[model samples]
Target chain A: MITAMSDASAPPVPGFVESTFSPLVHAAVHRCLGVAPPGDGARTAIVLASTVGDATTLDTGSRSLVAGQAHQPLLFMQSTANAILGRLAVDLAVTGPLLSLSTAVPDDVAGELLTTGALLLETGEADRVVLVGVELAAGDRAAAAHRALGTVPPAEDLAVALLLDRDDPVPHLPELPAHPPPAAPPDGYGTLRGLVALAARNQGTPP
Target chain B: MRREVLLTGYGVRTAFGTGAEALRDGVFDGRPAFAPVTRFDTGPYRTDAAATHGPAVPLREVLAETAAAAVRMAGLPAGARADVLVGTAGDFTALTRFWRTRGRDADAGGAAGSDGAGGAGVVETVPAWQAAALADALGVRGTRLAFTSACVASAMAVVHGCLLISSGRADTVLCAGAYLVEEENLAKFGSGFALSRDGAVRPFCADRSGLLLGDGAAAVVLESADGARRRGARPLAALTGWGVAGDAHHVARPHPEGAGLAAAAGRALRGAGLPRVGYVNAHGTATRHNDPAETRGLRAVFGPYADSVPVSSTKSTTGHLLEAAGVVELVITLLALRDGVLPPTAGFTEPDPLCDLDFVPNRPHKADLRAAMTVNAAFGGVNTALVLERT
Candidate 1:
């Protein structure tokens, strides 16, 4: 298993402006793809799981349209959650089956991502799969709504990407531990915080 | 015999109205559903025409209603163990409305410093999460997944759902694709020249321009053959094979040679152990590039038989459903197989030499269809093909 986490403030992909979500996805996907063994791109699949999705782009695009601003095609391009998935496939040349998914409940998002990766490999659809969980921290208005509703709002933006394949031996990371008290309520949305916690536990000094 | 994937139930919520009957009647009526866009302002775009479900309906409500309709059609128990997958291209009009409202408040300095909290509407806007909402709404107890692969989302979902059943991971799945006509969507596609120039969707016609957006949702209940048999469920059709491929050539345009699309069609046929395709549901979006490239793909896969096979694009009548096109076209193909009536491409006129297929133009054609194929392509250069056979 290979795992990577990008901080909430990862820089945008070079040359593409107005896309915060794609950069995070790009970073995570790059890291995970780097770890994948050399093989046929046709046998590799990707499943992206997110809660908040590309809300940053959508919110920005909607605001522009409402403000009567000029049409920004790049913004519209990134507004769809699958934009980054397509970019990843094009960039890496991996093209078996691609899926971009979101789960409403944050807690269940991580498990869903993991199970989907395993299912894809088990069904013999692909020899390898890239599983990415991403969530952009809510914007000010939405965050305020959560706080006003007494919800524990996301603390920071974050993304986690994992490379999983069938029967590939590696230093196995234990199942995620019980939730640690989040420092500052964590950041981003969905399973980012949980994924961050898992990455941290896996990277700490060996027991 | 190898275990087959069975489609036992289908439900549709489209501009023609709900259920399979509406879809059949609407297509055979030989009229395009494109009308003036009602859900949103098309701004300065050349065309403001789209196929819509009258007023805006919440995505969740449409999903629930269609899920119920599919369940009823399949005769599943009140609480069937089934997964649910939802394929959507982008946020619904309500989501954009939520953001637009928030932007207004921010501009007005009403809640700029309110610590980023949002209203109830924000809850539904979360990506991927809507699958869970749909699963809850339908009371399904199996896995819930969401997909957004542009035009190929729902078709990809159906392909994966069948794999899940074939692998014995799940017995049944509710695969649905949905889209809503929104102003943001219209402006983007219109600016990109994806919408028809004169508000007419004339696929494969000499004067073809582009596609018109459509709002709709469709769902099919898929189960393994054994599970259906044990439950005494009759198979409406068998989902025999599927092919999914990425163009990796362009962001919004298909490969000039239709390489990826041809590969997908070939893979589907090979997987199904078929020599020739009897009918093809073309992803004929009426755009200049799509029609010719799709024609090339059909020719590549069917070869000389391409001249004999009946090929038509129902988008001519229903308009383009974007992400929902995959599953919607699949359901339409299944209906064609069941009724032995090939749906027509409603707006065809003088044929383009580049597109030489025998498009069942302007009227339905009756034929003895043994197997059928439906193909769809997306903005990201993803192409998918699903092959189904009569039960």
Candidate 2:
């Protein structure tokens, strides 16, 4: 059961440069926490899912290195994808488990990041799991990667967060919003984006 | 809620060689394998040395070969579909070479390669792409996940494998980690002033300066006890327990006290229903921050027992495999259990008072080690602990 849900559609994060990906992820997670206060940081798990994670940063870092430009440690840091998850762990005081999942196809059963969160609860790994699914508009490298893997890149930068636990019954599958590029889709598109477009598509709906 | 997970087989490749013997000779033999980095020009870096892999092959190729080997070793019947989960930097080396050429082809997908589409044949590399391709190569039918969570990623992959087996989600899982030292990694460490000035990795030593990167790839086949019995596979050891925790302390640095690492080890021991482990395979990056913090972390959990536990860091010889360090170190620990000898902290010169735990310094300690705990801490304040026991 998703106790709280939120989505951030590529909002401009002030002073957050490098790529809009981190900010989008942070925004959705921030909104979800605001609505539903955290119970125990140590008992919570944070899982992030992305097929092509922060491709923008990867492309930029590659071009900079190839072009002989000064190497920015921040770009190198952000390129790992888990770096932000770590920062979030520190910020939210989440010590349970921080996992980042990357799969070629988002439709696979194991690729479902939300189900993983639920599994954590079912398996007694966490009291609650903050599941985040994010994808930024593909850069050249990511476009080629998507073309090769036969995966469709998201229309634009999009992120959705769901806070779920074991006690909640089946969640309400509200009508998911359609992707409108930077426009917050109402609900979800299914597992196509992996947080698989689970019901709460509102930009920032408090449960 | 718990089911037994057995370690059926393992595959490892390092500077030493490709088999269990290689790991024994290269890692457990207390030999330093650090050599000059040939993949990239190391003129701009602090030190020009690391435990580098000499192969010019593609990253996915290495993973595919390694995965196939593990499956064969596990004695899985032909066409046995198993999940492939690996912690890696993907094909960064090939990507860097592509960037060096700055060349493009009209057939973009073809350029990337039919499998990885970019393991040096093309310029694009995705962190998760190789794991999917490896799963396809092995014809495995289970889930594929790529963990890029810095140093602890592979250990976390192992922990996840345990959960999957215990939760009945997977029967046979191929859990592995591989990191080929490339320019980008060296440059990152160089700029941060974190590289070993003398090109020697000396974890827990008073004279220990810093860490050197290494080229390592290792795979462990985890099967549920029932699954292994069904296949008649020999269980080498059992992955009894595992745990993960975040420091929530800092992103770029370790908690001065190793708060997250201690918590993870404690959780793993508690879950394993054990009071103490006979041996400890430490993360021991040998950095100023990590050694003492890791010491405190161990002491925090085991209390006075830490002083008696024979602890060592194979990173002292393997260099740091970054994301691959956890699983590779795990492979070393499994070997130590198999051989009944603890791998030493190879480059130890003198003991640091802060890291006073018995480091098994400079020499392998032969003992009747029953169970060993391997702990790894990553840059993002994430930590993982795995309990492995002789079966």
TM-score of 1: 0.92
Would you list the clashing residue pairs of candidate 2? A176-A188, A177-A186, A177-A187, A186-A201, A187-A201, A190-A196, A191-A196, B112-B117, B112-B118, B113-B117
lDDT of 1: 0.76
Candidate 2 docking: what grade? medium
**Which candidate has the top score in DockQ?**
2
TM-score per candidate, chains pooled: 0.92, 0.91
Interface RMSD of each: 3.0, 2.9
DockQ for candidate 1, C-alpha atoms: 0.44
Q: First chain TM-score in every candidate?
A: 0.81, 0.78
Q: What is the TM-score of chain B alone in each candidate?
A: 0.96, 0.94
Q: Which stretches of candidate 2 lie over 4 Å from their true place?
A: A1-16, A106-111, A170-196, A201-207, B103-124
lDDT for each candidate structure: 0.76, 0.77
> Compared with the true structure, what per-residue lDDT tens digits does model 2 show for residues B23-132?
88878889989988776677766789998767556777767777778888899876676878888766776667555544333334234332232333442266677787
**Per-residue lDDT value at B23 in model 1:** 88
Off by over 4 Å in 1: A8-11, A141-154, A167-174, A177-190, A197-207, B43-45, B89-91, B103-118
